[model samples]
Target: MKPALLLLLLAFTAFQLALCDRNFPSIFTGEMSDFNIETISKANSIRREYAKKNNVANMNKLTMSFHLITIAQRLAPECEKVRPGSIYRYVLLKPDAAAAAHEENLKLYLDYTYARNRPLWNERVRSMEQDTAYHLEFLVAEQRQIGCTFANCTRTVRDEQTLEYTTINYGALCLLGPERLFQGDRPKWYAFDEKKGDPGSACLQGLVNDDGLCVLPPPQRGVTRIPKPTYIPPSTAPPGTAPTKLETDEINDFFLFNELRRNWARNNGVSNMWRVEPDYDLRLKAQKLAAEDCEKVWPTENYRYFMRHTDKTNKEVAAATHEIFKTKIDTILHEWDRKEFENAIFRLEELDRDTASVMEFLIAEQRDFGCASASCARTVLNPKTLEYQTIEYENLCLFGPSGKLMANPPYNYSRTLPPFNQKYGELASDCGPDGIKEPKEDGGVLCVRKIPRISIEPRKPVAQALVMIEPKMEMIQITAVSEHSLNWRLVAILVCLAIMN
Candidate 1:
């Protein structure tokens, strides 16, 4: 296929979606129980589907392919070239490393037309982060005049004489003053008006003497100076009062981190910092009365037993006295998650025992069968010791060493092996080429071989034998019977059943 069946890039590249299954944690039961695990779980499976759709890697490859096709069309403008509105299939390929691999890279197939296509380079090249450079959005935002409007602020202009920005005092902001005299205001000079000179024209008006010489008017005396206003602007705080602090915008604390941390911090009431320092400063001196609470409670150590009380009245009063607050940080989730996670370190028992099994719909399970070159999850249960096993993931893709399938490729999953059918044992085991599919030329992990038959010490049918049945039993490798031998095996099974009856 020139243009292969196209699987687009995934949505959330970093999302590690856990397998959705009924195998939930023990605490979750049903709706009638204390909590309905289903409510939270509904969001999980959705993540899987959403993420695959946004897969960055796939998107990058597709973009490369589209660009290539576009370039081809532009280059070969003659004839039909490529149809304008046709959909083409595509598959992502690993980038070629040896070539220029920059704009010169081309490993994807061009799909200018719906049905006609060819490998991008036929032999050309390929290329990770969609872009290498980090372009700060904040810088771009800074370059824009987003905050101030021309109505409230004057446009900055350069001074003609100095070739620098003219200084603006904005005295026009005063209700009593004339407009700030910008360059628009012209100073007009007038001829001597000896008879009755304009009092306001001190700079322009002049006098004529007997010699007919233009004598500038003598400097006027008693020019009254305007004193500074005692009244402050309403926007400024009064001299006697302190300015209030700026608060962060009240977006929803639906962020949950603060609440979750605070929940973890409280015991019936006292704050940990107050418990330790007794004199912790909360900077509420103006609003609240200062008290030496820590000194008073230190001797008695009352906070130790405060959490033991079950009554609401005592807790409420304690909360009023010892309000707790975590030191806020700047980053989004990383720091908050770290501090909250620390709550689990000291008190594992209080950790949420119930996991919301909401991911069930978001997952795709091979269901006792999966094909991959590697496993994200490798579960091992200890039957003798009865130990718990950590759940692992199913690798959507994997790599083998030196251009070969991995030693333990995902083409390996637990499957049942047929009883050694002497005449058809090989067929039943699916050890032949016909049994399992191979990797396509385009590339996909396929079943290579089933694990060899496991041997156990022969024992009498009635005797208890150590039967090791898994990682193979009910598991799939290259394990299944051929069609030709399947009928014979079925007949043999029928004969054995008849004899038993």
Candidate 2:
């Protein structure tokens, strides 16, 4: 071969290799630097917004994961086919060796109609965040990594009657992350801490860079560092001084309830709904009642109450109930879509029969309430054989002012009246209209009441108030009649219900 021809042939081969590198880079050793800077910044900005809304100061900014990017690249070819609007394809992929400790979130979008006018990456991300069905993943505080890739593809579709085929151009966006949305039965997307310090103070190493993000400090030189355990020990402060696990759960529940209430009211076209406030007195009364029994109970006149029971411990039952309630909200709203009622009215009769009436509690004018939970084990005796069995119960109770659910037929409802406005000599139209808005740490506002403060007497301690045992004995009979047995046996049992003292 001639020398000049050989050099030209080698040059052509090198150009082809460069093209392959740009089109489909090797996935085995990619890094965060592979993603665009703007993409990283925009994604982090959205996360920051959610963190602020959730009152979390230490939310970590997102970093791009190359493993996720490689996955996205591999799935990009699927965009050539069109899918129905109601169907979204979700594929779970195993993490690579480098990403073994990470979970994953994979999302794909194909715009069949937007071949000519593809949206910019920033706009596309915003659209993804706005989509109600898929937005939760982006809002999750623990999911702090993202990777995305886009592709332009064409699909060929055949007309059913005309016997013609046409090529349609489309754009596809694939997003990958180190975490998936709704990985567990958590009711909310973010963790809410009411006492979190200033912005970025919660970051690892307590550092915030120029972009206003919580970030970890750079690794130090020459020393091997041991990884710390994920669990942090609770403060050793005396009880009632430092927040307990139960108290944290209550705070989260309070935040979730108010947030859900506000969203529901807005969706249902109610504008004058007021935020409920936590009352320590009410909470204590609730705790006392909850420790009494495992059975469901209704509140008396002038107050509203809701109770939930589970086989779990007192600490776990509230979360379990919240998870169950969250799943029922959509169906409840759908069934009541056509109903017409006053904005602030709550009917106890409707609540009494509806299993999903927990939602009604949200709209109920139950301002100033507290929640309490308790667990106990009871022993049952079989009188016939002198056999005993143990059963456990957990209960959660919320007690508050009932909006008036015991009146006459249709008018028998509780109403949340607006707070009186002294400046204008009239009731405030909304929580913020009369300059009585109480700002909360979670970026929410509450309506303030102007009545003179009255001292509330403290109730007896929970240990003393709890009902330990039933004074009366209840008899139960169990009949055993089987096809294989020639005779029938009857067993008599005595149940003495008791709660932990």
Candidate 3:
């Protein structure tokens, strides 16, 4: 049967059943749970009815048969084929290997995708940061140009080159004229009145030239030469005024690393940085301070921590700090060791129970049955069985070797000469060619048939036993009746009753 058609019928039947059971008008009812049950039940009913009509069993068996038939029809002779042995091999061995190989393949694809995206994504983020900085600089420049200042300045030099005698000593205006002209302020330049032959044509207005030059319109001269504003490198800020370039760089580096750690935490929780050992406690504590004020401090602490652990200049202390940080972070992520801890805790308990069960099996009784010819054993196939006998204590064995481990290929059970084969005795009939039948001396009982066996070493030793007991009471009842003797007994009973009457 076509799988698609089969699936369709199943779905329809499930829909009908759900509609009937739930009293729903249709499978497409508004109630989601009802709709789901209706659909599922209908599909199952249809599949069940179809299977009944076709003598198919459960869905899994049906699916397997369906796949096998499809494969048989579709594949050329050279193509791989599935057989019973192949099925067994796949179940026993190949599936685990295949799953592992598939997992590795998936990881390879994922890694490839990750590697492909990383550089492009990183460059994009970097470009965005640069763009942000440019916009900030533009905003700051606009603020400075519009007379945004706080105080006054001084001018150390103020005399016109043309009017050499007129010296406008505007005290400090040249240096501290306005907050807008503070040391870090933007320098504004203008085209000189080159039409007037001013050699130093364009310059930052208000600055004092060597000969005390002045602005074109001469707003003020004091701000120009406030002692040349003492070449205060940005580094020369007052003791605690602000961060220096070196400090800023260190702080930024720390923030970048911290941000990387935070992102990894967001993406995979602690899992991503399981190997990274940063001082999360210190970072978090400092972070609690308002970022407007504490951002600098936090970054400083992180930089210090990074230096203590990662610096090669202090090898011994660096190694020790690294180990300390590793231990601290490992403790924080203790959940990662859940599997290891669980295995350690439960190891002995499981071993004890398994050993006890093996010992009980070793002490149990075993019996023998009958025998068969080598050819019959070689040619016939054994039915799967569930019978298990406790052979030796810890050295016990299953009736069938592999399957007996759970139960698979039927074991050789006909061993002893008895009134009936022990296996047949247990089953109440020797399975015959037609079905099941009584055991006979000619060894014609069909149940005793054996097939070729592949032997493997048992995990434990198998024990043989010699034992005898009365046949089970149920066996007596079943074995006592023969067709010929049953009729004779009826006849004799009738004659005796007639004579008495």
Candidate 4:
């Protein structure tokens, strides 16, 4: 053989060997085994190898997230129908189920490849880098929590040689999460300085070196775990105050808005979404404007606003005002979720800028806000019939002192600097000075901001008095007009009697 040809052949063989180092006796079959531990361990080993090769510090060991496991289970059914296309397309089809997952990797082997002994699970995990460098969930240093599962499936394909259809069995291994990493045209690797620090000195907070791999230290004994309640009722009116239904609703809205923002920030690459407290002044102003009618965007010089409209029934309006304000708020949020705003980046300068999209609610500078809702029946002239009709409308408005809904700036000051920029998952090291690392109920840690005490007083009763007096004055005028007519009639009768005498 020619020397050049032999060298090329050797290089190709080496590449194939790197792609699959270990071979299995047969295809994956039978019921799935509990490979969660093995999967996580092997994945971390690969991560450590990559880090060492790149001269970067090893990231924290990947832990299994049940949240991602549930998502993996959902995808397990689709493995049978897997085709040669983007795996993310399948995930995008079910946005709600997969919203929390940041990335997915799937390794599939058909009958043709099965003839040449399939690769073992660990080998597949190791080959992830060689298989597709862009979708390297295992190699990406930012991803820390993972959920993996295997599926065996069979499908019918036409044999090209025989020109006949044949049934073939296939096996697939799937992995999901660490959540916050956004997969784009190119992979976003963990930022690090090459060969600048000691082997383990580059490890972030909440992580330590476990041998060569960065890992979370074992939980200390005797530590108390706080029991999280499933549900907490909204606050009610104090003793003699008139219902305070609006106040209760505002309180509930404040909590829901902050919770949604926190969840999004934690799952995205955002690090500085401060806890939004209820501002009484903002709430009163929003409520007053909403009550007038929810027709168009109400832009104020000092505040940003998000408004939503829904068709509602009289019963819904009454119920919302008296008892189910939280339900109404939930419905409005659901409407926003249905829009799937997280799927893309939208700028405030987009063609349709009047209405605020989900991006508005996610502005990092939005520190405090208030929400208000109003329901009314509007009379509109039907375009076709030229007849006036009453239409029921429900409007929800959220306003804050800051939080402009512009495009995300190119640089984020909140994100941690190099060597410690991994912000999501179990070993997140990006909590700022006032933030506390708190474990999420599902899995992973969140940098919870320490909210300072706001000394603003409760909403003054002036606005409430103004709302009350309008109706009362109308009632008083109606009574006065009736009494004046009655008095005039009595005087006319007395005048007639005097003329007759």
Candidate 5:
């Protein structure tokens, strides 16, 4: 053989050897197993491997979320046919299906906690809301599919013999397992069919070459249309308060005005309406009083004095007053002729601006965390890392599971940040109080938690033999923590192959 050809062959051999030694294909395969394992020990092993690859003391929320996404891709029946970010969005926005098993266990715990004091009436009432249960189910089922493919691929393909079968993993979500809810059904948010030809479309055609690289679908496509919800204005009267006689005209006009305003707002690209507050107590009080003296009141029987008098046998008078007040609302709406309509329209515009201000404030407030927001999850589990940490006042992570300190700068979440575009999609746009700029092009930031760090003595090599050390049994005990570690390892292996090759 020629010297040049021999050198080239040697390099290829080295590359192939590296893949075998490090379990490259297994990373994706193992991720699939990580997704389905009920055993906590195995999960911890996987997560620990994943964590070590990143060299971070602990996985961040977004990393955890990515694992779940990885798992979902594997287990998700329609994962391949679905767009790239579709399953990710489905898990974060809706993890009912994937999380079904965990949620069911959670439900049991909750039931046990509340069993003693819970009223049967409450249960009966809850049963009436089937929609709520369906929504929850959707989340669990979807969560089940997250990060599944990575784990499964890692475990299955660790042996080269099975590498050929692994190509089945690539494709649109619809090409995966059981029929997905969205397979035949078109979702309003995801424009899968619309972007079939668009390069940015999440779903890409799965193509397998003799060389083993899983081709992902195209990038997101089209103008990235996101439909905003229509806002309905509240009544003018205060909440729980019926309209007082003076506010009757205002309340009556509100209903009619809202009808016209909504249509106009839709056309004008301003659909959010401001809520109107009305007084309920005053209206009820007047109604109760009028009802009690209806038969005794007469229209001409000193009605005005009867309203104010303490002692008056003016049941006839009371009746007259009630009729006059009843006509008040009628007069307001009917008498509104064209002139009143014009004035009401003018007032509505001003109200719309006020509504916008209120909504903006609400949108800003949503940035604060410890829960899932449109932007990120601070209170709830981090979708990326699957780790839960306290959200500081400025939308920063304060601590890790081992209580390692991680402090980020005080940031205005409302502003777009690098993480927004990369990690969070609509949420980044909707909730921007967390001072992150546009999502970084690279996606995640590598901020290590320096406090409460654990120092371990470097282990000595054992005659070229790899040391197989299991993570402390305790870590695997926790399902989430373990799952995270496993997911980390699988992702690391894939990443390593991509880089080295």
Candidate 6:
């Protein structure tokens, strides 16, 4: 985001106040809270690893937040009683044996009786002296455990040679055999019907060669005609406030006025698109958008919104979407050949961007499909022999997983992104592929067994590793600490956060 835009969004004033309110219902910023002092401490410890990656200024943001929070909590008397700069400079950058005599901390540490007063962080230090269990619990609390736990499971794993499988792990989720959810009956291979060339499509023809290089065909030139959505956008209102119904006679002679204005634009060609936003009433008959439709383009609603809101005549948005799709796909296609391509995968994966990877995977899968199906034989040019070899499959039907057909409602999703072209066909959750369907002729409604998903993740191009590590026995045990004990522990969390920065 541009700095101006970011500032406006963060500002208490401006239209951003409305934008900010939309997300206020769920605050996952992970800001400092009093929920758990230990949890905060663990988080602060992890935060330090990330903090070191940046400069001191970035680290100060974390400390400053703690400072602000503490300042806000203090009363006017407490503020007056506080020593200026004392908290910030408590830790000496360097130490000297002689200088230690001048510091008050030396006496507090040396004299146990005097230490009864409790030096600034005495109780907080004691809290850390307990067993490692406390730290483990704070890191991976029981409340967050899922998928697998140690109670019913042992270290035994499946022995492939003996064909014996272990079912101890994942007992909570996999009440049956462990492989029950892990195994699938669906055919693992599916590709574009090669004979039916995917013209102007982003799905390329290729494979990850034995050399570990992507040997894909160059993208074909020219754009195919883009398909409009099957669900015609209702004569609808854009975001913000919904549009109110306008009676036919709401504006006397409105239809005639609409027709006249449209005809004038038709006579003027490209020049008229700029004259004004095509009147929506007039647009009931207007086919395409002119330059003026850009104003009504509510971005986050997805490209479909643009498709519906645009005039079929407006070549600008359509051309833009096409170029965007091609540009993103081309970049991916090129990246596939690079050694550094693996680095493109982000830790916080993006389903939309990962679509490119899936498209390529589909292409690779199809390379085998032709040979796998008996009727169709695939001929491969062997890199080793430079001779073409024909490969064949015994009439097998390849089916990709259920996730390939995903229908996630997008937020601010761009339809022009690669793998989103209409040529790839509409992605529907309950339609073709792994989805169930009714039998033709309605001969006893068709039934397809639905597979239980083992994960919270859907079978999409972007998949996260669903993993949780069991904390040591100590962390799982929540021991109660006294209220006074909590005060300094909480203070330790605040101090650690500030000091870490």
Index of the highest-lDDT prediction: 4
Local distance difference test values of all predictions, in order:
0.17, 0.36, 0.22, 0.40, 0.25, 0.22
Q: Write the per-residue lDDT of candidate 1 for residues 244-307, one digit (tens) a residue.
A: 3210000011111111111112201112100010011112221121122211111011111011
Clashing pairs in 6: 137-475, 287-312, 288-311, 288-312, 288-313, 289-311, 300-412, 403-459
lDDT of 4 by residue, 203-299 (tens): 6543577655555444333321212312222223344555365765454444344444443454344555554556666667777877666565455
Off by over 4 Å in 5: 1-43, 50-54, 61-83, 86-362, 365-501
lDDT of candidate 2 over 54-158, digit per residue (tens): 455666666554333444455567645422111111221121221111111111121221233345422434443323222233444444445455444444533
Per-residue lDDT of model 3, residues 1-501, tens digit only? 234333443344333233434332321234423333333233234433433343332121011111112222222132222111111111000112232233233333334544687664334333322111111111111111110001111112212122223211110000000112112221211011112223223223211222212111222212210111111112212354544343233222222222222222221112112111112233333234322232122112112211111112233332333333333323322211222333322332232222111111111011110111111000111112233211111111111100111111232222111111123232214333433321333112112222211222221111110011011211222222111112211222222212112
Question: Where does the lowest 10-residue lDDT sum fall in candidate 4?
Answer: 91-100
CA lDDT for candidate 2: 0.36
**Can you tell me which runs of candidate 2 are displaced by over 4 Å?**
1-165, 168-294, 299-323, 330-365, 371-395, 402-429, 432-435, 439-444, 455-501
Question: Residue 89 lDDT in model 5?
Answer: 33
- Model 1 misplaced regions, further than 4 Å: 1-99, 102-286, 291-332, 335-501
State the RMSD for candidate 1: 40.5
Candidate 3 runs further than 4 Å off: 1-243, 269-317, 331-501
TM-score of 4: 0.38
Deviation in Å, model 3, residue 373 alpha carbon: 93
lDDT of 5 by residue, 200-276 (tens): 22221221111111121122323111111122112334455643433433233222222222222221222122222
**lDDT score for candidate 4 against the true structure:** 0.40
- State the weakest 10-residue window (summed lDDT) of model 6: 171-180
> Taking the tens digit of each residue's C-alpha lDDT, what string does model 6 give over 356-430?
221211211110110011222334344445665543212211212212212333411222122222122211112
lDDT of 5 at 171: 18
